[model samples]
Target: MRALLLTAVAVAVALPVIPAQTWSTTACGPAAVSVGDYRQYEGTGSGTTPFSFTVTVTTAPGCTATGSVAYATEHISTGPADITATSGTLTWTDSTDAKLVVVGVVRDGTPEPEEAFSLRLHTPQNLVITRDRGRGQIIDDDLPPVETGLDGGKICWRYESSAVEVGVHTNTPARAPITVHYRTVHTGSNPPGYYPVKDGIITIPTGSTRGTATIRLKTEPNLPDEQFYVEIFSPSAGTLGLSRVPITVKSKR
Candidate 1:
């Protein structure tokens, strides 16, 4: 009889494997979008005609989107028409990124503070909007020797017209914002009561030639024609030129 030694066999126990934490689902994908901020010079008249700035859009590593995303811009200090296009789209893929090119006009004017605008992301198309609101800053380039003056030299306001746009101009664009002190002067030819006493400051922005002020006129259908002069005095920056401007108020028809 073979010596059947009762050898105790040690059996290995298999442990159950645990899976990873599922952060994403089929419906709620892992794709996300990011928008980048940018800053550039406002450009000059002699430099480039149409200056441009860029904003970058990046897709997440796990992005699986195939189409594009749309975006819109809001003018903070600049006007709607000042920037080339208000709304645009960025095309992207699972592995690619997109960029937005903002083109602007290089207006020659005084050097002033930096101007800014805003950009927003829209229409994610099922993707996540991780980051939005791209801030854009436009730096002024015009330097010193910027001469300031009055614009709309002579203007006529009809009785039907409630207000008129008057402005102060500069010979050259400055590097900083300018405050022009102006007052309505009532002379022998022009009397009071036709219009209210107007005295204020008009701020001319950087890289801009003119800053405007709206003057409200009194409607006098039966009164005679009236005239008054707008004179711009001490300016915050740069010397004043062509300070006086005449405004004539015509009687009602």
Candidate 2:
């Protein structure tokens, strides 16, 4: 009887010390939609509290349905809690080239699942990019500047109003992803040699008409100077495209 009494007292003492548990669903996890596409999503909530969610695609130039997000709220005042609840599936297509998706989730007045999902696609990475020089294919093989002296190369980038809009790529996390830029030596094997730079990403000013610039890649004498990889990112113009160039660096001396 004494043992039973001790057990009952312990249960009573511990009841008040428990904390509320948080819950979430994978509705916003890396959502993928083609350019001009849309997605419809839904999920069940817990207890009497209302459930809600918000969407963000760090790789923007993307939008919700109706130039905004479409949503409907449902209330479950009395139902057995079921883990079988499913979040909505978004419906989307290629628009403004391509887009990346990131989503957040909340439940029962608590924002538990933050940054719980992400999605990647093969749509417009850049608006306008070069496929090859007049008579030569673009190329670059060196590598990032971490080991090499250079980052990228003196390859040129081109874009037009039709190719890209001022705010088209504002949502992309990095200045430009791999697909938006292409890497080709200023002049292919035109007397190849050791070329080096500080980093891989190159900077060019946006021109009202068109623009050209030189980008360098990191290099090291100990590394092979004969061939290197040039990163290429093509504009979505209508969809995202990423590519790479190969350069056969000839010895300068």
Candidate 3:
């Protein structure tokens, strides 16, 4: 997630009458030396490596002087390693820059009014959604009923709603909400167990996969399918369209 704004403002001279040149450098937060593990400036302004700065200059009708200002860069790791059994992935990052300005009135007389602005940058977002490919078939389409289930590794859905890390002009899209639906099919009398009825998959085609309604349900044989129509809608776009999966059953007696 990234955002940028070029704010144009009238340079206030701090109500002080100046005719020539003026220069001042105000430092901020020691100006972060590095980002997570990546250095920014390589110690260009700060003492440590990767140090960077934001320079601002204000000149009247005629002024000659250099401006020196400092800013900080902080990172809030995305897709942290602590989130437990979360439905989807979440990310956090601090990408805001500090705005420091040095003005020379560039006019008759007006107070600089302790001008201060905030500059923030965004870090890259990391979201992951996963689902297994259709391995063969659950029913097998054979006789004797399979009565078995397949494993669909970690199914996930990920998205971001904010863009503070990706920086400006970044195609890195934020995560979005996702929902799932499923169709269940079971034969024979029945059995008891935590069957692989409904689950979510993270990996998908593209776009935010959110649940708009319920998952669509249908039976192979319409007659016995019974209420065979369940509606499922995803608010966001994703790879998986169904959520619940049912295995077929067979009885000899």
Candidate 4:
């Protein structure tokens, strides 16, 4: 007889969260069946790791019972029909015994909110099922979609300063390393004296939300204020939210 032994990490051994749903009971022929408390796990996009559920049968004196239970996904995907098990066996000896059902949570690239599934007991042989349903919750670990753009629509540059710092920001933290490409385009005539067209890259490291790009400027005295456009484009990771920003370079007095 292959008996299932409770492991140190078994959900039955650990204190479990009480399920919010109410349970119904039926008279056992001699023993009663019940599922352990609810279980939860993070939803990683892997098939190897699975969620474990414990189904238990409490036996009365000299009461040996047999039964079957089924697993169904209420808001999760487990298989073709979203069903994990159609007829899983549950057996009870004179003492209490438990069976564990391991089921996988399907993965997807699309980010989703927390979801759940359920297991129910049925078709018992010489036993009653009291607390039939067990629930499993999946905490979503997928990163949400993010957008990146310039932190400000306009920046002011003093004629005497050699460089101006521009901020690049994302709506949310980067899931991976992100590179934002920006360049200064001539909106009007370039400022007098060795004005170099600025092409810069701002790198936002993984888990960071912001980066800075430096735009070097060269200005001469007694010249009209000039304007230029900073074009935000070609982000390596996320969609571009704001594309164009204006910068004003004031000539020295």
Candidate 5:
């Protein structure tokens, strides 16, 4: 009988072939659904430094997306809210793959100017947020770099003087407008008309931290006991402290 029909077709090909039962959906049409968009984090002032934002979620293949994603902070007073977010609630099982939601920003070293905030995405059940909202920027880095000094070291001229007032101090407060440069040093008795001796420019005005450089001495009339020096060179924004300032000319009484 043809060997009993070839042993019954090899026992029906060794039987056993079953795999079709992966039903567990929460229903999410439109090719499964997706949500991703959060790119804007520029903060490193080191007040605790930490500015990160990445929110992404895409599910479909057997779906199991549970939700509760809510983030807040929009147009805050340009500062204060610190920032923090690692999970606002978003669980997924049998996921289609692609899930990451992290947002953290908390660096308050104090010193602001460029600031903006916005990252919103709320209440999503079966999952569907093709790009909620994202826009964050905190670039102020705590503006600290503006130091110049010479409030008083010495200044006494009265031998044909016309002006004398040297006081330039700035540690912070001049967001704009600055200029500093002065020269004149005869050491001691170089009498021939000394005062301002050429080279000057001290104009710091924007919020004013103090700036005054008015020197002009040359009375011409047998001068002695002279001692000159008013130095503070090249400074358009800071760093020049104690810049040498001493002027005493009293010999014409």
Candidate 6:
């Protein structure tokens, strides 16, 4: 009986081991999607210029993602005057992951305050949006120089020793020294000679909004109420306002 039991155990051990039926399932589905952030962009110079911004869509590894995304401008806030409009669209594909949109900016030939607007992403087909909105800034690069008539529009000089101040104004602060070329025109009063016009250029220090040019009148006894002109011209930057200035020298009684 013992020998028979041992033989049975040996037979059972010798039998080949059968592996459990293994089942594997393959994963099939759409890829995970996400959108990148769009930052601010700026444009310079005058006239119509093309400006563009980009939007990015990221897909999970090994993802066979396919869908379409749309972009448009929203919450557009223009300055006091209408400057320009923003417009564009973006689409997603397996081959391309990023897309760019171009917008038009109308740069008027005048100095104005900064303007701003925003862009929005919506109607995403199969992608997740990490950031849906981005802010855009349109910087005003138009800097113009305007000449303000003499401080008081006119200055009366009683004597040659008396001097009058003429001013030039700018719409924006000067980034660098601004020089204005000027000359004197004797419109009235002869003889005794006109006041010596020494400096032809008025240098406006950096960051200053205004600069002045001085003209001294010549003291004459019987000169028919002399009048002289201080004409401003050729500014380093921007346009000139009231280029010509008039000064009256009241004749001595």
**TM-score: model 3 vs. ground truth:** 0.18
Please name the candidate that would achieve the greatest lDDT relative to the true structure. 1
Give the TM-score (vs. native) of candidate 4.
Answer: 0.42
Candidate 6 local lDDT, 112-210, one digit each (tens): 665665667777776666677665555554534333333435646465456667777766666555567777886644553356574488877767778
TM-score of 5: 0.24
Q: Which lDDT tens digits does candidate 4 get at residues 144-186?
A: 5457888775545466587767788888876555677888777
Candidate 3, 45-72: lDDT as tens digits: 1121111223222233333223222222
Number of clashing pairs, model 5?
Answer: 1
List per-prediction Cα lDDT, in the order shown.
Answer: 0.64, 0.26, 0.22, 0.62, 0.60, 0.58
lDDT (10s digit) by residue, model 2, range 1-253: 4555434443434446667887653332233223122221112132221122333322233432222222222223212231123333333333323222322222222222211221212222222111111110111111110011223232212211111111112122221111123344344353333343223342222221122223343343433234545443333111221234444443323
Estimated TM-score per prediction?
A: 0.41, 0.20, 0.18, 0.42, 0.24, 0.40
- In terms of lDDT, model 1 sits at 0.64
Superposing all C-alpha atoms, what RMSD in Å does each candidate have to the true structure?
18.7, 23.8, 28.5, 22.7, 20.3, 19.4
- What tens digits encode model 1's per-residue C-alpha lDDT throughout 1-253? 7887798899999989999877764452545666777665455443232333343444445445555667787778876644655577776665444555565534545676767787777887645677777777765655544567877655565666877667778877645566677788876554553455467778877677788766777666666677777888766544567888888777766
Tell me the spans in candidate 6 whose CA falls farther than 4 Å from its real position: 1-46, 79-89, 144-253
Residue 163's lDDT within candidate 5 is 62
- TM-score, cand. 2: 0.20
Q: C-alpha displacement of 252 in model 6, angstroms? A: 71
Question: What total of clashing residue pairs does each candidate reach?
Answer: 8, 74, 53, 1, 1, 1
Q: For residues 130-164, what per-residue lDDT tens digits would candidate 5 score against the true structure?
A: 77666665544346646677787554656645667
4 against 5, candidate with superior TM-score:
4
Instruction: Identify the superior model by TM-score, candidate 1 or candidate 5.
Output: 1
